[model samples]
Target: MPDAPTGVSRALREAPPDRVVEAADRAIRSVLGASGTVVFVADYRINGLWPVLDSRQPDAAAHALQGPLQRCFSSQQPVRAAATDGSCQLYLPLSVWGERLGVLMVEMPEEPPESVVRRATDIAGEVALALHAADRETDRYRRARRQERLSMAAELQWELLPGRSVSHGSFQLAGQLEPAYTVGGDHFDWSLDDGRLTVTVLNGDGIGLTAALLTAVTVNAMRNARRSGGGLVEQAELASDTVYYQHRGHRHVATVLLELDCATGRAQAVDAGSPHLLRLRGSTVSRVPLEQQLPLGMFAETRYALQEFDLDPGDRLFVVSDGVWGADPSGRETYGERAMARAMRATRLQPPPEAVGTVMRELQAFHADADLRDDAVVVCLDWQGPDGRAD
Candidate 1:
């Protein structure tokens, strides 16, 4: 008889990226004689969790996913709890490279041996790696986390955005856009080049597909320029010129293209009608002054200039869109500068991912009962300066 599938190698060999979770579930269930297995991955927005391969017909899996599963995510660790009065299960967090991806739930007839539980954790880690690898193309995974249906434009925009966060020893970056289900005209992109990390955030005015198309054109224009060996100012000009020539000053994008030297903390920024940045140091939060230039697509001859700044280790920079600060969609009538300041002060010490979520939650509550009138975005990075430290 053929040997039964086992371990990370066996599981990965048997499943495609789109079906990796289901493949993992079978592996764990076989080893533990577990009655069932379910994989819960983080939603696209990173705001909550959702289940994968919960095949129970009556929707029982949804009810089963609560309790210890939630604890696994909140605590960022593996958990063991009774699945029912007489049965026990284990929940393990799915993570890779310090990013918390989601949770794994294994329901067994009884508590398994310690050795078996340890192996399960190992499997969960492998599963996270697989999920991350397959995220971009897996409709099952993406559909599970989506809070609502996305418009065609929002779907394209979402596809262009990175996976919520990325980090290195010298710095950690996390970003989010609100009204999680539908978003348009707000996007951010990042890349590392020659020991420097480049980040660009854009906000296109107006609404619907037009704004999204403009953002797509602008970001791609910037990308093409950067690929051709241009710096921040040149990238800004290329995007601006592309928009101006294509739309004839009819549309524009507010942008901030920034490059940070992870080795030296030397920072350069080019602003095109974007909001002033916020800096948090120790326990103080303040707005750093930055000159604004004409937005992209506005004029044929507009030029953008580079602005320089310094980021000491432990300083955090907050880049946001006006929608984030505009407020009063249906809640507070204005998130206002004071409200934003208070939120920043409250979350100054949290890690980037946690801090981003906390800020989004507060904004959602503040905009209670109202549709997100505009795309709201927030991107943050903590500079660790040279020597490569993370806090």
Candidate 2:
């Protein structure tokens, strides 16, 4: 047998973002005088920016990100406003491997002599290089952790999954879980019995070990409920109750349940504050809106709602977690539902599994080799012609 696949590797997981910011601050203080300095990362697409760390003027530092900083980062050039005025305000682009990471801004009370200015430029270069190295280190950590967690989570998730992708001939289904790291909160399961296919997909809040734990609890709860021989609605209710009682006040689990009928092609879904599920049919891509509610273990006041839809011959269903929606080319904005719709349309011609892969690949491209901030997951189910053929 082939070895298990790792999710996000440990090497890519780098140190926490907070630590990276702190290191950047220390570098600034050591290189430049103690007047005041700040460091911010530029958006990947070079559109807008945001402050990752700021020592002197925190609020102002963030505000400064929105200005013409993009031009400096894009051109990999430095600006010296009041540079010639004797006062000191220097803006330098943080470039690494010919790509801009962000910028470093320094404002000293007195203009340093010529020697100091030259040294400052050199300092900026070193700082930029450091930041780049840090980012790469973080990526390595993420990849290693992802791979490890993915191997474990995939094993657990697969064992809990319905034996085959397209089972019992009534409906066709296949799902894959991709984490920004070794483990993910996103998952799916399906079982066919007595002509009904029970499909489920969930996105537990956060990622890493915590999300994985909650997911384990959730799937176990479902399994126990399933063995109780309860109907779909009853099983879901019992499972929710079990989760609530089991992890009361834990506030980090979100799940969606769907029951499909082989004969009628009808699907009944119960959504508890997860992302939207899409149904595709050639030109028309239908958006299945899930009623918003608190995640599991949040409130006794929260309730799960069940919605139903009929599947056509060529209809397709797709579900995803935050990682997919968070894929933004500009990095400043999220790739919202609209973008997901367009992506689906663009890849409509591909096979079900290939289409899903296409989305993941595109998202990786948008992030520009950057590790995801959270777990990413996507599952596609198609109900067209020959059920589970490997075509």
Candidate 3:
């Protein structure tokens, strides 16, 4: 029989975040021996992992744990390896469903048995789920996942976006923004209503505090329109007019608005000065043609024309910000559409989250300096049709 979800997390459910993590460590010790336990939580952006429990040495600098922790996370499997002190360490990926969370580690003085490892894995999953639930009540997990302090604008911007990822009956969507601590005005939002899904991506011009405000204004306006039963065209115009007039035409926001009917795979969009949409279908890569228009906050009485397309089962669509492809400030190179096309051809079969991660890595390789002047954002949509095929 399968191991029961461990009761170790039950007591921690109502406790503070730190106490919850401590309880998890204690549970690991109970199952796998009194091994020194450290829970490594994924940073908000999933770029890296950090030790969360207080018992972990302050100067631990356990950089070596990254590799095994990552493998455990991506593979959703238990990892057993030798620590620097020749002792055994067990790394269990902490996740529920396909939502990849983080990793849990326990250091044992000696190797453990299969049953011990199996129990520890089960306990870790339960703990991870509890932490996620507790997050709805406290800022402990949220604050801990942050790599650095966020500016006031960045904080508001974070609140404007949805939980980092989401899924529906037959479709999945995921998004990411880089330089999270200082992201200027990059944002993405999605909602599933009945058989229709609405998504919006925006990159407010400029950086720093003002840019963040522009993004907020744009998103809230769109949200207002969405809530009012507005169609794609109305949603775009309402957001544009609201920002353009409210900001006295002084600020603007580039955006991509989409309305997809999950039942028929029919899609419509307005490309308001953002990057062209890339559609990946079985081994081929192509850009959905778009007639770009002036960004929001620059023109009133502007009506955004809808571009119609269809999503085949198994198709993954990606919308990006100029930060991901525009020419570098140095003018020495550009991560252009061709680069994106090439990458899509290589990764068309992967899931939305992985594809987004790969594109970010490729952009880093393109710049080579690891310095991104603007916030980098990518939103991916995977649509599966009535037949349950994503073709």
Candidate 4:
């Protein structure tokens, strides 16, 4: 028989967020022999403090009424208090970049050493990352349930996108999708085939289940064409026909297909009613032109233009669904390409994930944290992949 685990260890393992917070406090106390610990998660309102974990409330949730944590968030700093029991209370701000996540307070029998403070900061950072991940997970859950009748189109769209993040050789890629519904009509994908990175970002016109269905068909047709050994431009034509005939209507869709040869540093792209591609070189920003033609679903007869480019080291590619550029923050006020360019320039040196974080921060700042009503998708590609033979 396996040895029974300690009751204390089991309790800690089964702890909720507050319990986890308290556990963190206990870890800090053990390392520094502190008296108590208090964790405050900043409320969304940015007003006051709410306890996340605390030893003072053994039976209660330890959460403040969204008041105190708001204060901590507004101050963008931590507040320390010393109780009358001769215990030293230290408040530390938990933030990533400039985003104030929350505050943590630990009470000790006596003043803690500088080492304790350093250790606390590290703990706070980890807590901040975990909190963000949790929040994002919650957001996804809420999004999935926002609309009744979970559309299969939405489910299929999610499955067809890239697998989380791709990190290999000299390339780093990250993508995100936001839908106005359980399924919207925006999709982005990339894969390594024959030593080349083939990328596709498409936005189907209209909304709801119909748009999603159209997008699903478009992606499949495009994939089939590519697998059939057709070139990028040829694949676009084949995919366009497939979508048009599949839908069998005057209804049309807009799409973009890009094929990147990682080994040769050469790329070919075709934009069908999609926005101009944002290309980055060092700090310079340029656009890959959208040639003459209608969106994928908009035309029965269409001529797709092929755009080719030779990428240099450290080049970056920023693509988005129409939802992003089309999303008006406060109605009639659009988040334009210029705004994206500025954000991209600000975090050019960071990886795709960090760069995306910077971009999201800038977007929020631009709107003063106002929510973008429409679905938004953004993908950042860094072509710093291996310096292998340029075939």
Report every candidate's CA lDDT. 0.78, 0.59, 0.77, 0.62
**In model 3, how large is the Cα lDDT of residue 18?**
49
State which candidate, 1 or 2, has the greater TM-score: 1
In candidate 1, stretches whose alpha carbon ends up further than 4 angstroms from where it belongs are 1-6, 30-36, 54-67, 82-88, 97-100, 107-119, 329-333, 387-391
The sequence of per-residue lDDT tens digits that candidate 2 reaches over residues 84-200 is 556676677765433345677777667666655655655566666556556544543122112134455554554454422342444446555554225456777767677777877
Q: How far is candidate 2 from the true structure (C-alpha RMSD, Å)?
A: 17.1
List ranges where model 4 is wrong by over 4 Å. Answer: 1-153, 179-183, 290-292, 301-303, 331-333, 364-371, 388-391
Model 1 C-alpha lDDT per residue in residues 1-391, reported as the tens digit of each score: 0122246547866688777877777776675577887787787667567777543443423323357876787566779997556787789988776567788888878877787777777778778888888876667777777757888778878888756777787888888876666788988898877788999999987777788888999989999999899999889998999999998998899998889999888899988998558898877887777788888879997888889888888899888788887777655447756777677777776778777777777777777746777788888888886766634
Name the 10 consecutive residues with the lowest summed lDDT in model 2: 1-10
Better of 3 and 4 by lDDT: 3
Superposed on all Cα atoms, model 4 deviates from the true structure by an RMSD in Å of 8.9
Clashing pairs in 1: 327-335, 328-333, 328-334
Order the candidate numbers by lDDT, best to worst: 1, 3, 4, 2
Highest lDDT scorer: 1
**Residue 191 in candidate 1 has what lDDT?**
82
Query: For residues 43-129, what per-residue lDDT tens digits would candidate 3 score against the true structure?
Result: 756778777745444553333334778778666789999867768988887765445667888788877788778777777778878
Where model 3 places Cα greater than 4 Å from the true spot, the runs are 1-3, 27-37, 55-57, 60-66, 77-90, 96-98, 106-125, 136-139, 386-391
